[model samples]
Target: MENILEASGLTKRFHGLVAVHDVSVQLRRGEILGLIGPNGAGKTTLVDMVNGTLEPNAGDLVFEGRSVRGLPAYRRAHLGIGRTFQIMKPFPGMSVLENASIGALFGTNGGERSIGRAREQARECLAFVGLGRRIAQRADALGGPDRKRLELARALAMRPRLLLLDEVMAGLNHVEIEEVIEDIKKVRDQGISILVIEHVMKAITSLSDRVFVLHHGEKIVEGSCGEVLRDPRVVEAYLGRRRR
Candidate 1:
């Protein structure tokens, strides 16, 4: 399958601190690639560079066969790159539906030109993320899991071909996490590729087609879920030294 997104020799620096160093990865069409690592691994920085929220000091980023190195965030979104932040940033005062409508209004292909059309698309996205019933509620009214759903809904409303999800399951309980896992499957079924950065080992192992491990701002391993999970380096880096 063709790659939907590619990053080569990607590097980022902030005030002499190298946050990401010579990292490279690819996301294939219709695939879920999980990025896992301990805190301060530069996973979020890599995502930001790919999604155009940050500029890389070196390397190239290609999406859909074109270079997106200098594109602004909104331009990237218009090109079918959508992402949810680790910290969910819903418009607190807006209703759930209204927040999603913003995505439909400014997303791919210049988004919807009419409020009615945007609202219709937003409603469908909300329904897809199991938030249809909460459309009339204020976004701030939702608890943790539902807030994550609202974030997902907002991104899906953009009609992206590639979605970058950052720790969407961060604070959910077991049952809620399972529901999110299912919802992600549904999203993938709709022909969208996903690159997820997660700390939850169980969820990442279960959902990822392949896993990439990062340590100290560099990629240490990339392989099938089983292979990556069992890697000694990965285990040591994140799971700590093994017991005898």
Candidate 2:
């Protein structure tokens, strides 16, 4: 299968500290790739570079057979890359539909030019993420899980070919996590490739076509979920020693 996204020798540094070191990854079209690691493991940093939130000091990023090394975040978005922050960012004062409309208004290929069109797209995205009932609510008024849905909806509103989700399942209870997992699968089923950063083991394991494990700013393993999870190095890096 052809890779939708590919990074080679990706490295990022901040003030002499290497936040991400020599990382390489390939994400195939229509596949969900789970990125798992401990906190401070540079998972977010790596995604930031790929999404154009941060410039890599060294590496090559290719999307859909084109190099995107010097592209700005907005340019990348225009090329169909959309991402959600680990920290949810909503237009707090705006209605849920309006907040999502921003994504529709400024996303891929310059998004929808008409406000009415954007709003229509926003409503559909909200419904897709199971947020349709809350469309009239203020974005800031949403509870935790709903806020996560808003984030997903907003990203979907961008009409992206590739979606980068950062920690979207954090703070959800088991049932809510399962709902979000289903929603993610639905999103992927629509032919959007996904790169998910998640600490929720069950959700990631079940959802990812493949998993990449990172530790201390480096990738330790990449393989099918069962293989990666059972790797002793991965267990030590994140899951710790098995309990007797």
Candidate 3:
């Protein structure tokens, strides 16, 4: 499969502080790539740049073989890029269905113009993420896991080509995590590529085709989960941090 998204020499700076430095990554057409790191590793910064939430101080981005540099978030969404924030934000005043409908209303290729068509597509996305039963409930009333599902549903309703999932399993029990792992796999089965940023070791091992590691905003290593786990640098990074 060809590369669906590519980031070259990406860098971000906050005043005098370097947040990300010269990082490069590629996401293939139909693969799940795991990005792991400790806190402040710049993983979220990289995703934000890709999703057009933040501009890179220096870098070039290519999506679907076209340059995407400087595009706004809405433009990126129309270009088939979808993302879920680590701290998800669902519309508090809307029903679950209404919240999801917002995606279909403004998704890829300008999305569905008719409200009825958008709602129909939203329902399918909700069902896929197991939020179908709660479609009528207020978005603010959902529990942690269901909120995660709602986040996924909204992203899926956008009909994206690439999904940037940032810790979608956070705060869930082991059973819920397992379900989410499976659900992500199912999402990839639909021919969408995924870049999963997660701290869960089990999810990384179970879902990643290849794993990449970042530390202090730099790419330290890239390989399979087992390979990354055994690397002396990665081992030291984790163990040394724990000792502090």
Candidate 4:
């Protein structure tokens, strides 16, 4: 299959500390690629680079066969790349439907020109993520899991061809996690390639067709879930160095 997103020799440095170092990864068209690493492993940093929040010191980012290293976040969103943040922050003082409508207003291909059409798209996304009932409620009034769903709904409203999800299952329980897994599968079914950064091993194993392991800001391994999980490097990275 063809690659939808490709990162080549990406590196990010802050002040003097290197957050990500020479990392290269790819997301295949219509596939879910899991990115797993411990805290401070430069996972979010990498995503930030991809989404245009930050620029790499030495690398190139190719999206849909074009170099998008110079594009801004909103420009990327308009170019069919949408993302959800790790910290779910819905638009303050806005209704659930209004919050999601922001995505459609500035989404793929420069978004819907009409507010009415945008809200219509938002409603469909909200319903898709089980937030249809809360459309009229204040975004800030939502609880934890609901906030997560709202985030997903907002992203889905963008109608992206590639979705970058940052730890959407972080605070959920098993059942909630399972629900998100199914939702993500449905997104993939819609032909959206996804790059997921998650700590939950079960969610990663269940959702990803292939897992990419990162350690100390570098690629440790990338393979099938079973193969990567059983690798000694991955075990040590998650746990600790095993004593002989």
Candidate 5:
């Protein structure tokens, strides 16, 4: 498979503190890569840089074999990059369908220009995420699990070639997490590449083709799930963390 994204020597700093350091990663077409790290490991920062929400202090980003380092977030989105937030951002007063419709209207390559078409696309995405019955409900009225599904549906509505999911399973119950895992698998089957940041080991192991681990803003390990999970450094980091 061809690489859809290649980030090399990526770094980020916040007021003299390094949030991410000299990280390099790749995402191949139709592959799912899991990003795992303890809190403050800079996983979200890395995702932010990739999606253009934060500028990397150094390094280059290549998407579809072209440098996207200087592109704005919208331009990257137009280039077929879509992402969900760790914190859900729902548009209050808008119904779930309306909230998702915005993604279809403004996503990749100007998205669906016609409002009617965008709504249709949005409804399709919502139904795919099992939110078909909740389409008319106000966005903010949804519970935690539903909110996560809404986030996924919104991103899916973008018809992204590459999707960055930031903790979509966070706070979800086991059943909800399983459902999302299945939904994500279906998405990958549709040929979308995904870079998912998840702390849920079961979900990550099941979804990822490979796993990358970060510690204190540094890339400590990268390998298949079994290899990385059993690495001494990874074990030590988590073990030390649990004792803290």
Candidate 6:
């Protein structure tokens, strides 16, 4: 399969600390690549680099066969890259439809130009993420799961070819997670490739075509879900050795 996004030897540093180091990853078109690691393992740092929120200290990011390392976040978004934040903060005093419409107004290919058209797009995206009933509700008034849905809907409104999901299921119950899993599958079915970072093991196991593990700012392993999960390296990283 063709790759929609590629990061080779990507590195990021803040002052004396290296947040990510020589980590490489690829998201194949229509595939969901799960990014997993313990806290401070650089998963979000990697996503930040890919989406242009942070410039890499070294290496390159390629999207659809071209280097986008020099582009700004908005430029990358217009180039078909969309991302959700680990910390969900909806626009204050804005309706859910209006919040999602922001994405439609500033999305891939410059998004929809007309406010009317953007709202229409937003509605479609909202409904797709099971938020149709709450479109008129204030964005900040929605609870945890619904806020997550709003975030997904906003990203979807961008019509992204590649979506970076940063812990979208962080605070959901089993049923809510299952609902999100299905929603994500539907997104993939629509041909959007995904790089999903999650602490939710069940969601990762169910959604990812492959899993990439990071540790101490480096690539520890990358393989099928079962293989990577069972690897000694991943096991040790997530859970300390059993005292024997």
Tens-digit per-residue lDDT, 95-139, candidate 3: 999999999998999888999999999999999888889999999
On residues 38-96, what C-alpha lDDT tens digit does candidate 4 reach at each position?
99999999999998989899999999999999899999999999999888889879999
Model 4 lDDT at residue 164:
92
Error of 5 at 28 (Å): 0.9
Total clashes in model 3, counting residue pairs 3 or more apart in sequence or in different chains: 0
Question: Which segments of candidate 1 are over 4 A away from where they belong?
Answer: 241-244
* lDDT per residue as tens, model 1, 1-244: 9999999999999998999999999999999999999999999999999989999999999999999999999999999999998988789999999999999987898888999999999999899878989999999999988999888888889999999999999998898788888888988998999999888877898789999988999999999999998889998998788789
Candidate 3: 10-residue stretch with minimal lDDT: 235-244
The candidate with the higher lDDT, 1 or 4, is 4
RMSD of 2: 1.8
Least well predicted 10-residue stretch by lDDT in candidate 1: 198-207
Q: Residues 1-244, candidate 6, lDDT per residue (tens digit)?
A: 8999889999999999999999888889999999999999998999999989999999999999999988999999999999998888999799999999999999999889999999999999999888999999999999988999999999999999999999999889989999999999999998999999999999999999999999999999999999999999999999977789
In terms of lDDT, the poorest run of 10 residues in model 2 is 234-243
In model 1, the Cα lDDT at residue 84 comes to 90
Per-residue lDDT, model 1, residue 233, is: 97
Task: Show pairs that collide, candidate 1.
Answer: none
Better of 1 and 5 by TM-score: 5
Residue-level lDDT of model 5, residues 184-213, one tens digit each, is 999999999999999999999999999999
**Count of residue pairs whose backbone atoms collide, per candidate:** 0, 0, 0, 0, 0, 0
Q: Can you tell me which runs of candidate 5 are displaced by over 4 Å?
A: 241-244
Q: TM-score per candidate, in order? A: 0.96, 0.96, 0.96, 0.98, 0.97, 0.98
Better of 3 and 4 by TM-score: 4
Which stretches in model 6 have alpha-carbon errors above 4 Å?
none
